[model samples]
Structures are given as structure tokens and as C-alpha cells.
Target: MRVPVLNPNYLLTSVLFVLFGSFDCSELDMDGEISLRLEHSLDMGKSWQDRGSLSFSKARSAIPTVNQGPLSDENLSTLENLCSKNMFYLIKVTGDGIGELQSYTPACTMLDSSLAEQITLFLDWRGNPVAANLASRIGVVGHKVTAGKFDTRVQIQSMENGPTPDTAAYIQKMEEEKSRKMSGEKPDNRSFFAKYWMYIVPLCFILLINSAGAPENGGR
Candidate 1:
């Protein structure tokens, strides 16, 4: 006996759903004492599952010594280990009456030597300076990390900026930064629509087909 094949349109729709569903995006709200959040998605870019938490604080520091740079043999060795082990690390320092300082390094192992060098330079140049500037302004530093294939970018924001126009503005800013870093485009309506065109187009096609058949199918 021969089995029947699934309809092509059905197969296509299923594939599309799976593809779009595999892209897992998650948010971790760091509440207290170092925490680790893991999310995994099998499809290229559709949905994700939380893999539970790992105690990241038990590992080595995420941020290297500023004075040592990336070329230091110690730092290089650390980087090699991090790369081989594929680690994600975060550090948080909180002081009374002073703003908190947080650092995140994700997918630290994928970084090439050159990129690692740049990262070290960036940290040495902007990390402390930015933290000190925020400290002077009576603001605490809140760090967030988004990991990528080759490199990771960190964002440091002020926690004591007072009530802004909106409570969720920080999330929006982080989303924009992540979108920009991933797409090389600013987070705007156009970019958002572009990113989701696959879904939009398919929905539009279904709508058009149904609308065209509606009048012919019934009097109502």
C-alpha cells in the first residue's frame, strides 16, 4: 500500500510555521545573587524553550583585568579556555549609596583573537570610564548582554535615572540595540515589518484568496 503525500500548501505552511516558530527570544530579569538563564531553540528562528538556570557566579569573572589587555598571556589563556568551554558569565558589584555595577560576557569562546583584542580595548576604554561617569552622576550601572556568533555587545544603563516617561523604556532601548546589532538597521517600523515579511506575506495571500472566493461562495 502507498501512503498519500501531504498537500504542498499544507507542507509549506507547516514549514513556515516551524521555521518562524523556532526563533526563540527570551528575557531574563536578574533579581538577586548571580543567576543564569538558558533558552534553546531547535528551528532556525522560531520558538524557544527555557533550559533552566545554571549558577554562573561560581565560575570565573566575565570581565578581564583592564590593565592586562587581550595580549597578556594570562588573558589569552583565559580566552582560549572560555572559547573551548563556551561559557557565559556575569559579574555584579553593589555598594551602599553607590550604583550597582554589572558585567556580562556571553558566548565568550567564539571571539577571534582580533575581536577579543578590540573587546579588551573597548572595555578598557569605555568600561571604567562609563561606569565612573555614571557613578559621578549618582546613577547605578545595569548591564545586559546579548550573545552572537562572532562577538557579543554589552549595554550599560543607569538604574537611578528616576521615573522616565515610561517604565519599560529600558527594555525598548535594549531591544533596539539588539535589533540594530543583528540586522545592521535601526529598530523602526520598516525594519520590523521587513523582519516579519514572511509571515505578513503569507497571511496576506490567504486573506486575498479567501476574499476573492467569498462573494462567489455565498450570498451573505
Candidate 2:
């Protein structure tokens, strides 16, 4: 497979951690350790099952806020290993002072090196600033990872068809970004082939070849 560099819009603070932020985000705790629980939803949010818990050595914010730059890589490699799955993942954080912060809703994999690249954030659906403020009680100083390239741009999921203020804002933001890129307001310095070769090369060498050649003759 043709390898491509990390998405310019998607920021990987450290070689290990990938971060996304937006208007509605997660709360951070400064004291004590926080327990990160993973909830799996094969059919969107219809049914959620308790998968496992992610334990941070110290308190941290699961979501990145406005003032919060790029989230550092605390245990990204470990998370990639443990959090590898095709189903949708809902990351929830629970700890002292902070009851529960529904942090990340993402399609996660250790092999993002090959997965389709799109920088998106899960916006705030709860609209609970009180929760956010309560969440803010836990500071993100030493607890949160802070050792990678900082990226703070997130596009909303327009294709998913969710009706919410955060989603609406995200869609608008994505449209604006697209317009800007088209109008040269935002320049793309990356090569076209690097970004697209992986998708193209396979069709020519594998799929097309398989279709053109004779069938595998009784599973060869």
C-alpha cells in the first residue's frame, strides 16, 4: 500500500497521539487518576456495551478545549493496541470531582497509517456547560499528554446526517474550509499522488487484475 503522511488538518501531537478539538469539547481534571471506560456500539448508539477501562496515571481531560492545544500522547501506543476495533467507540471518563465526561466518539485503529484520513470531532450534544465546568475542575496539567505536534482543526461529520448545533456548526465549518482550499485561501502543499496513490494503485494492480484474469479455477 502506498503510505501517506498524516493529514495536514489532522494533528498528531506526538508520533503516538492524534488529537481533535472543537467548540463543544471534554472536561479535564487536575487531581487524582481518571478512569477511562470504553463503550462499544456496533449499530451506532442504539446499543452500547461496556468494553473496558483505560486508566491514566494521573488526571487529564479526555477532550481538548479551546485553550487546550493539541492533546499530548500519554499512552497512545497502548491505546492503539487496546482500542483497535472497527465498531464505533464512545470514550467515557469518570473520576473524583468529575462524574463522567463522555469524551471521544471515534472510529479508532492502530493502523490509521492506512485508514482513510479525515479530521473530525464529536461535538457537544449535551449542551451542559455545568458539566463542562464541573469537568474543568479536573485540570489537565501533568495528567494529560503534551508531547506531540499540536493540531486544533476539526470538521463536523456532515455525511452522518445528525441534527444538532455542534453538527451544524461542523458542517458549516467544513464547507468554509472546502471553499477556502478551493479559493487558495488555504494552500495544500502535499503531493496529490501521495494522498491518492494508495486508492488508485490497488485498483490497477489488484482489483482490475483480478477481474481481468481468469477466475481462481476451483480456489487454486
Candidate 3:
């Protein structure tokens, strides 16, 4: 009896397909809120500056809300004003009819590394230590900023104040793309095998016949 040799090309192609498929589905378990970017400049009239952007998608969903009294149009206007302005001012967001107000300085220059540090510190006060000095310099008191149950919205009042644009629309579009995957889509059905299989298979049969007819280990 004679054992048949497997085609090397078939073996190589199968291995490549399996490796690519595995790499695509590696991270399918972790669940976290999507973050959106909020960038603004410090100057009010002149060109806008890139102060620093923050991701609020995760924060918005994670924070709890309380049942405050009816929100006045004035309050909504105030929060919207804070978000759209370019000055440096402090925003005191109240939760459940009780709120406190605080003030801070705004970034004077966009490229100012010191100011950038201050902003990062102010934002991260709830998380780390190096953030303390930065927050202090920027006049941001972590505990002073409060929120209400229904106060799920974020207020971005500037201390020195300037013109900040609402970039929510753009951020939402980008997030939508990031969470989408290529699964359930049609796979590529065109390959060397699919296009020329008929010809190749017949050629392979011919080769096998020729090989068998050549000799049997050089013995009769």
C-alpha cells in the first residue's frame, strides 16, 4: 500500500484563514461607556483655542441622578451658556434643588503647558495625587462642584470665560463608528481556489496519474 502526499498549498491557505479570523474577535467581553470629546478655546472673540477636551460619555452614564424640582429655562440656559462660552468661569451645578457655585481661571494661551497641566489636574482630582497641585492652581475645588439626580447634564462654565462650541453632534457620529464591527457581513468568496478550482483539480488528477505511472519505488 502507498500513502498519498497532501498538497502543500492547501495546507498553507487553511492556516492563514484561521489565524486572521481569530485576531478579529479577540476583545468581545468588556463593556464601558463611550467617551465623547469636548474641546474649546479660551479667547472669546478671536480664533478659538484648543484648551483641552474631555470624554463625558462614560461619566454621563455612570453618575446617578436625583429627582430635583422642575428645571427652569433659566437654569437650562445657564448650563448651555457655560458650555458654549469661551471665557474662564466656574460652574456650580446643583443637584435636587441644592447646588453650590465656585469660580476658577481660564486658559490664557492654548499652547501653555502649565495651563494644560492645571486643566488636567482639575479634571482628575477625583482620581490621583499629582492632580491636586494642578487643580489648586486652576482654582478648581473638587468637592464644591455638585450635581442633582435629574442634573445628568454637564456644565462647563469658564472662570475667565471665552467661546466654546457644542461639538456633541460630531462626537456622537464618531462613537457610532467605533462601536460597529464587521461581523455578519459577507465574506470574500473569490480566491485562487474559487476562480480556478475546476482547472486546477483536473490538473491535479493528471499529476497524480503521471506520478503513479512513473515507477513503484524503482521496483517491478
Which one is best on TM-score? 2
Query: What are the TM-scores, per candidate, against the unseen true structure?
Result: 0.21, 0.22, 0.19
Provide the overall lDDT of each model, using Cα atoms, as 2-decimal numbers: 0.32, 0.33, 0.31
Predicted candidate 2 versus true structure: per-residue lDDT over 1-220, tens digit per residue: 9998886433312211211232123233223433434333334445555544433332224432222232225434433434465433333333444454443333342123212122232222221111210011122223322243222222221112122223234445546767988888856556755543443354344334323422221111
Ranking by TM-score: 2, 1, 3
Which of 2 and 3 is ahead in TM-score? 2
lDDT tens string, model 1, 1-220? Answer: 9999875434544654553343222112222233333233222114443423322221124432222112234434554565567653333333333243333343242243233211211111111212211011112222221222112222222222111122134335546767797987744555645544554465556445423421211001
Instruction: Show model 3 residue runs off by greater than 4 Å.
Output: 1-8, 15-20, 34-36, 41-220
Candidate 1 has an lDDT of: 0.32
Clashes of each: 10, 10, 19
Candidate 2 residue-wise lDDT at 189: 59
Q: Model 2 reaches what TM-score against the true structure?
A: 0.22
Worst 10 residues of 3 by lDDT: 125-134
